[model samples]
Each structure stands twice: as C-alpha cells, then as structure tokens.
Target: MKKSNQQLTTIKTLFLGLMVLILTSFSEVAAQNDPVRLGFIPLTDCSPIVMAKELGLFKKYGVEVVVTKESSWANIRDKVLTGELDGAHCLYSMPFSVYTGVGGKAGSEMMIAMMLNVNGQAITLSNDFCGKVGFKQMNKVTPVVAAKLKAEKEVTFAMTFPGGTHDLWLRNWMSIAGLNQKAVKIITIPPPQMVANMKVGNMDGYCVGEPWGGVAVKQGIGFTQIASQDIWKDHPEKALVVNKEFSEKRRTDLVKVMKAIMEACIWLDNPANRKKAAAIIGKAPYVNAPADVIENRLMGNYDLGCNQGTEVYSNDYMLFHKGGMVNYPRKSYAIWAMAQYVRFGYLKEAPNYKAIADKLILQDLYEEVAKSMKVKVPNDDMKPFSLTMDKTVFDPNNPAAYLKVVKR
Candidate 1:
C-alpha cells in the first residue's frame, strides 16, 4: 500500500508540472498576440491610423491595434516614451526635437518608422488680418504686424508645439515676411483649441493641421492665410513614430503595422475614396469635426474665408501616397527640419545632421516593408530642395552653407 501511494503522488506531481508548462506557453502566446496601442491627436493627418483600424487593415496584416485619440502633442510624447503607447501619428520633427531636448528630455529615443502624410496643414489668421492678408500673400502680414507692434499691442501667434512642424512653418513664414520673431509672442496651442482660442481673441494667428484649419474658417473666426505645402511643396508633416524598444523587439509586428498603414495611405490617396474617409475620420472617436469640413480640404478644395474665394489645389493637397513617394522616410527631410531648428533659434547650434537622421529614421526597416508591399522608394536623400513660398533652396548635403545664406 505504501508503494502504491508513492507512485500515485509522483503521477500527480508530473501532471501538475505538465499543466503549468501548458499554461505558461498559452500565456506567452497571448502576450505576444496582444494589441498594439497607437495614439493620435484629432487631426485630418491622423487618417492613416484611423483608416488602418476601421478598414480592418490591421487584422488583414495579422495584428491588433487600439487607436487612442490623445488631447495634445505633449501627451503623445509622454505616453510613447513610457511604453504606454506602441507608436503614434506624430509630427515629423517631434522625435528629433525630443531627442535634442528642444521639446522633451534630451537623448530620449523616439524612432520614425515611416512618413505618414505630407502637407494638408495651414496657418490661420484672425479676422483682424483677414482683409490685410489673403492666401499666399504672407508678405502683406508684415505691415499689419508692424502696426500692432507700433501700437504697443502684443502680436501673439500660436503653433501646436514648440520645435514642431507647425512651429517651423509659422517661424519660416515670419522670417520670410520680415516679421520680428522677438516682437511677436508665439505660444503653443493644441490643434483642437486653435479655433476656440482665436474665437476669444487669444491669438492673432495659429499654425495647425487640418481639419482645425477648416474648422476655424467654418466658424467665421479666421481665414486660411497659407497652406503648408505652399511653404514647402509636399513638405513632410506627420510620421509613424515608435518607441525604440518596440521597434527593436517587435520588429516583425512593426512591419505588419507599417504595411497596414501604407495600404491605408494608398487608399486615402485615391481621390474617389476621400469622401468616405473624411466621413469616417471626422466621427467623434476620431477627429470629432464636421465630415464636410474634413472632406473639403482632403479633396484639395479650400474655402478660404475673408473674401479670398475658393482655391483648388490640384497637385499639392494633402498627399498620403503619391506613387509611394510620400511614404518613404527621407533623411534629407529630417536634416532640413533640424537645420530649421538652428536657423530659427530652437537649437543653439547645428546637430550632427547625418548621424541624427540615420539614427532616428529607420530607413532599412522602411525599405524592408516597402519592398514587401511592392512600393517604390524615392531616392531623394541629401539633395537640395526649394520651398514654394520663398524659393529658398535648401541643400541637405551642405546644411551649414544653406544655413549661412538663409536670413533669420
């Protein structure tokens, strides 16, 4: 009887061990299959992530994604750094800014997985300057600003974030138009709050991504002064930014997500599908704006208020995938953005542009994903490009020389 009991106890131990192993394996698999959480600020540029989830592209690519609508850019940066978010629809210059300590902690690593979309951002001015400055007539604003400064009234302007794309655009406009940056107060305002702040006469102007620009015009508080593309035709605006750990550890899953977003980008570029996309992203959970407001600018139709009449941008509207050109992460673009930081006094000195660009931008991974998707990558790195507004040529190969010649 003693021998029989010992054998039964050994058998029970073996069974329990086997069950533990099985449970552990199941838990590991479940953990690996957990959903990737992505965050986005409610703007039209966030369409790629939204479309990816809504169109079931995430599942099609064999990954789960939870899209969170963040309230501000600072929140997006914090959550991404803490691993609370896997990735985000972020400003193209945000990671660089954070890494360099212009926007966040210096030396923080945020990787640019790929470019999400270009253009579709704008600078809106209050009705105070509506009659003074019309679309693309940024030169005319200098006089009004001078008048304001002469009157001892603070000439306040706002951008979505410091050292961000909108900030650079607003600064560039001010520089070219000869407006004194020091004389004007440039504050940071969240994209959604731009129109509301303008409504209360809090700011003279703001630079932000759509559909807020559209929203501002719709509310009759402001007028579209200039589209971002007009500043630099097809300029890089937003990106798919991921944490360093997520990019390194979950590389395959990141590739899947990139592929899915790229597919959504292709879909978004299709002119016929934009109306549907606008309707979907404009919902409360996404951009939370009027569908018509989002759709108008998405289709390249701008109802520029202040009697400027409507203008159609046939070629330079918000581009998601223009034959895959818009999706390629160009290091030259990053170089230009960082150079602008120095040019506008955001950075005290120039950064190691090539090293920073190569480190932060995951070109190899983007190439891998692009090749898998049969997408053509553009070979336009380290080349000189000109802005449409000022015709200032930026030669990425020699950023220092370009910086020397450009007027601040």
Candidate 2:
C-alpha cells in the first residue's frame, strides 16, 4: 500500500511540473490571443488603433483587444505607467516625458513601437479672436495676447498636456511669432472639451489634434490658426507607445500589434477608402464627432476658418503611410523634441538625446515588423529638416547648435 501511494504522489508531481513548463513556454501564446486593453484620447489620429480593433485586425494578428477612451492624455500616461493599460495611442513627445520623470510622473521606461499618423493637428484661437486674428498669421494674434498678458488678464491658452506635442507646437508657434510663452498662461485641457471650453470663454486659444480643430470651426467657436503641417511639413504627430515590459516580454505580440496597425495605416492612406474610414471612426464610441466634421479634414479639405472659407489643401494635410516618410520613428525628430524640452525648461538640461531616442524609439523592432510585411522604410535614420513656419533648422548631428539659433 505504501509503495502504491508513493508512486501516485510522484506521478502527480511530474504532471504538475510538465504543465508549468508548457504554460511558461507558451506565455506569449496565451497573451497573443488574450485581451490587451489600450487607451486612447478621442482624436482623429487615434483612428488606426480604433480601426485596428474595430475592423478585427487585432484579432487577425492574434491580439484580442479592448479600446477604452480616456478623458485626458495625463490619464493615458498614468494608466499605462500603472500597467492598467497594455499600450496606448500617445503624443509624439509623451514617451520622452514618461522616460524622463517629467510631468510629475515617476520615470517609467517607455517605447514608441510605431508611428500612428502625422500632420493632422493644429493651433486654434477662440472665435472671440476670430476676426481679431487671421489664419496662419500668428503675427496678428501675438500682440493681442501680449496686451492681455500685460494687463494681467487671464490670457489663458490651453493644450492637451504639458510635455505633449500640442503644447510644444503651441509654444513654438507663439515663440516664432515673438509671443513670450512665459507671459501667457498655459493650461492643460482634454482634446474633446476644447471647443466647449472656448465656447464658455475659458481660453484665448488652444492647440490640439483633429477633428476637434475642425469641430471648433464647424461650431463657429474657433478657427485653426495653423495646421501643424504648416509649421513642419509631414512632422510626426502620434505614435503607438508601449511600456518597456510589454516591449521586452511580449515582443512577438508587439510585432503582431505593430503589423496590424501598419496594415491599418495602409488602409487609411487610400483616398478611396477614407470616406468609409471616416464614417467608421466617427461613431460615438470612437472619435464621437459627426462624420462630416471628421471626413472633410481627413480627406485634405480644410475650412481654414475665421471665415477663411473652404479650400482644397495643396500640401500633405495628414498622412498615415506616405511611403514611410511619416511612419518611421525618426531618431532625429526625438532629438529635436528633446532640444525643445530643454529650451522650454521641461528638462533641466538635455540628457543623452541619442540614448533616450534609442531606448524609447524602437526602430529595429519596427523595421523588423515593417519589413516582414514588405513595407518600405526610410533608408537613413537621420534626415536633414527644418521647421517651415519658423525656419528653425533641426540638424540631427547638432541639436544644441540648432537650439542656440532658435533661441535667438
């Protein structure tokens, strides 16, 4: 009897051990088809992520996904930091903030596994400043803002978040036009609430991603002073930001996710499909704006309001996959953003810009996934580029020198 009992116990132990090993070996398998909760703000650039889940692309790539809309960018950052979210659609400059411990969050290692889209954001001034200001003419808006500042009026301007792309664009736009960003009161507001806040007379102006920019014009609350592309043609706007743990442990899963989004980007680029794309993304659960509000701008038709009237945009209005020009995560752009952070005092001084870019922007992994799908990538990682609106040159080789010139 004792011998039989001993044999049974050993058999049970072996079986359990084998089970553990199998589970551990296929952990990625479990996670790949498991539900990954992703966070996104209600904005047009979030479409790839939204469409990826909605169109069954996430499942097609083996990642069962959930898209939760967040109230603010800060919430998106915090949730991802806490592991409450698996990944997020994020601001171009946001991962840098997370990696650096800026914006009052403990430094969390982050990575940009993919670029979502580019050139669809804008700087908008309140309708009260409508006739008072002109499209793409910050020269006219500067003095009125300056006067309000001098009088100690609220002179409040809002962006989605500090250390976010919108804030940087607004700051650079004002700085180039000789408006002291220091003097003007800058506050953080969520993207969807922008037009409502303006209607309530809460801010003098704001910079945010579409279709809020477009909605503002539609509602007669504000006008786009400038599209972000006008400032820097084809500049990157949003990206698929993932936490470091997810990038390292679930690398295969990340590849799957990236491939799916890249496919969606390809889908988004085709003009023939944009109307349907716009219709799907415009649903209440996604961007929650009218299809017309989102569709027109998504197709490069711009009102350029404050009565500027509707006109066909000549330049690249927005791009998801412009033959990889706007898709690849450029290390140089990250360096330029870091230089701006230093300039704006977001960082005490620039840390190793290259190190940060290398750590946070996973170009190798992106290339691997992109190449598997036969998607073309930029031949060079570093590119020579300058800001169109400000004429500020961002030489990737010498960001510090570029900063010095921009400072003057």
Clashing pairs in 2: none
Expressed as tens digits, the lDDT of each residue in 1-408 for candidate 1 is 999999999999999999999998887677568789999999999999999999999999999899999999999999999999999999999998998889999889899999999999998999999778789886788998899889989999999888999999999989878888988899999998899999999999999999998898898999999888888889999999998888877788899999999999999999999999999999999999999999999999999999898989999999999988999999998998889889988889889889999999999999999998999988887888888877778888899989888978
lDDT of each: 0.92, 0.84
Best by TM-score: 1
Q: Following a full C-alpha superposition, what root-mean-square deviation does model 2 have from the true structure?
A: 3.6
Identify the runs in model 1 with alpha carbons over 4 angstroms from their true place: 1-30
- What is the per-residue lDDT of model 2 for residues 283-323, given as tens digits with 9 covering 90 to 100? 98888998997889998998877879875665587789987
> Residue 28 in model 1: shift from native, Å?
6.6
TM-score of each: 0.93, 0.92
| Clash count of each predicted structure | 0, 0
